[model samples]
Target chain A: MATGAEQAHGAAAPGMPQLDFTTFPNQIFWLVVTLVVIYLVLTRLAIPRIATVLAERRGTVANDLATAEELKLKAQEAEATYEKALADARAEAQKIVAEARAEINRDLDAANARAEAEIAARLAESETRIAAIRDTATENVRAVARETAVEVARAILPAAASDPAALVSAVDRRMEMEGGA
Target chain B: MAVEDGGGLSIKPMDQFIVKPLFRDIEPGSCMPPEIVEGCLKWYEPSNVTLWMGLGIVATLLLLVVGTRGRAIIPSRSQSMAELTYGFVHQMVEDVAGKDALKFFPYIMTLFMFILFANVLGLIPMSFTTTSHIAVTATMAIAVFVTVTAIGFVKNGAGFLKLFWVDAAPLALRPVLAVIELISYFVRPVSHSVRLAGAIMAGHAVMKVFAGFAAIALVAPLALGGMVAIYGLELLVAFIQAYVFTILTCVYLRDALHPSH
Candidate 1:
């Protein structure tokens, strides 16, 4: 078997070194060209796309946070408005209740005043009727007493010597005695 | 046996090793001549695999840019994959270094992908292992160190220098701490580059040695069996090395962005 060193000397063909240069040169050149091309593709194309994607993702996250904040603010505003409305409703309800209570009280007071006036007028009318009745009774009693005195005088005197003055004096004395007894 | 067919002893292929040169045209000391180490800023030879790895880096950048040209709500597949990778790196940066340090994600991700692809490509048959070379790895490490240092200065100006002297030391121990910090800062690139290159080179060397053993001991089934086991282990080591390289880069970037930690 031929050793590598012996084969090197034995295979001293012409243009071998030059051919080595050309062959290796083409291979290395193409390899380098390919590498450069790949690098360019990566840097100019792939890397930028990747960066853009990342930037977009960041933007999305920020936008989402901003939207969340806005929504939270809106919710808070709604809560505040709801609370205000509730308070207004409560205040209005209280005002209505107060007015209703006052109106009822006023109506009750008017009714009470009318009842008192009616009672006072009835009492006055009853007092006036009682006085009239007393006056009539006194008059009837005086008329009856006078009539009885005249009847007694006529019974005691004779027909021929009938004098009105003498008979009245006698009857008055008798009536006085009877009244005293 | 003493009949003379030639003046000198006839040479065979096996005898060449024991004899002087049969071919006089070949220059002495010309075989396997040492190649000159290239300068860092030279226009990289397109034939060199390191240049190809660098091209791969550029390709990754281009793919990202073109994929993300028109952003949509629902992404195309290329766009989605790109986004996923970006998001993954972004999250990692944020998680490792905190949100304040996320600004360095682009640079870190670039470094990670470039190293990753270079490491992976080296695993292919006949492909050049760019990260395996000290010069290439060191260059990358130095670039990272410079960029991070620049970023720190840009962000904090003179205060950035305080990262080495002020933050880690008590007032009484400031001078001693400054010396130690300076040493460590200087050692950063060396450690970073060596770590990557060493792992890759060691792994490749082991794989080659085992493969050679397997070829030479073809008749010995036990040697073949051992080689099989070594090959499997090498595959795992390859992935692990790549991962370690990427993670270390991330850690270094984290340190740069947040020196307080």
Candidate 2:
């Protein structure tokens, strides 16, 4: 079978076709053409297009990163501003609270002073009234003592009734004696 | 052709590598006469190589060109795939060939895409593997070699020869080392081309041999299993070979750009 197949295709069939010098020109020619065409396509169209796309993608990514950074800075600034306002508001609130406390304390102090003064004045007025009432009672008691002395003298001696003044003088003298004792 | 005279299974493993014209008036199973085949397989004749190579080119265009049509920053699936491929090759070129060598990115990208697609496309059953042919691989390697060499001279002029002069070596041994370096440098294209073609050809040929064993009743299962395993391995080899070729190209470009030892 091998011999018959060889005889059918002649001398070229017995050996490796790769070594066949006749086909070299055809193979090399086509290979060169193919390479040339491929080179042209890559250089002219494919490489440039792909490169541009990649470059565009990179540019877009860079732009996005830059925008993100800018926004981040803006957000940070806003936060700082918010923090400062909060701090100022806190300080102002503390100040207002302190001022309210001082005003209330001052008002309390003034009211306490006024109440103490009124209490002192009321005590003095009560003392003076007590003194006056004591004085009036003493005067009444002396008058009653004089009347009693006069009655006693009248009861003792009816003839001595015209000497009432003398009995009063005597009661006075007794009162002076009791006061000295 | 599968049956020998004694009725035993006779497999021609090399038969698949036969170059034939795609458009022929002859019947499918019957082989064309040598004269007719020779007449048709001229330098301009489109063979399986042409078809497969053209398919590879189409696949490349579909991935790199049509896939990225939207040019979306947030890429679609196909567009992302295109970008991934682009970034992969771009990074490879930059890393291996250094930053300044990026000027040759398109060329390296072309080589990588073409070979990668060709190798992968060849994995399909009944498909022709253009990369398996030394003619194809050798042409690419020679082109890389010539271009790199020219760039080296153009960029560094006489200093390009300094690549062979190892300053670190002992003075007495420098001449010997230079000779060895020169010879190895010349051998670069040969090794680069043959490595890809040989690896791919060997894997395919071995797979064919194992497939030939599938005709036997007892070993058929083993043969099929082996073919599957080898197919998977070939898929890996296909990608790896393309990567090796491209990286080697980048390494060569690096040497040209900075030719110090």
| All candidates: DockQ | 0.07, 0.30
The TM-score that candidate 1 achieves is: 0.50
Q: What TM-score does candidate 2 get on C-alpha atoms?
A: 0.79
Regions more than 4 Å wrong, model 2: A1-12, A110-181, B1-13, B25-40, B209-228
lDDT of 1 by residue, A1-181 (tens): 2354335444543221212222333333444454455555556556556776878978988999999999999999999999999999999999999999999999999999999999889988888998889778755654555555556556654562256555556656665687579
Candidate 1 lDDT at A139 equals 59
Ten residues in a row with the worst lDDT in model 1 chain B? B13-22
Alpha carbon lDDT of each predicted model: 0.60, 0.87
TM-score of each: 0.50, 0.79
Best of the candidates, lDDT: 2
* Chain B TM-score for all candidates, comma-separated: 0.67, 0.92
Candidate that would win on TM-score? 2
The sequence of per-residue lDDT tens digits that candidate 1 reaches over residues B106-189 is 556766666666666666655566666565566667777887788777777777777677655578898888888889887888
Error of 2 at A151 (Å): 19
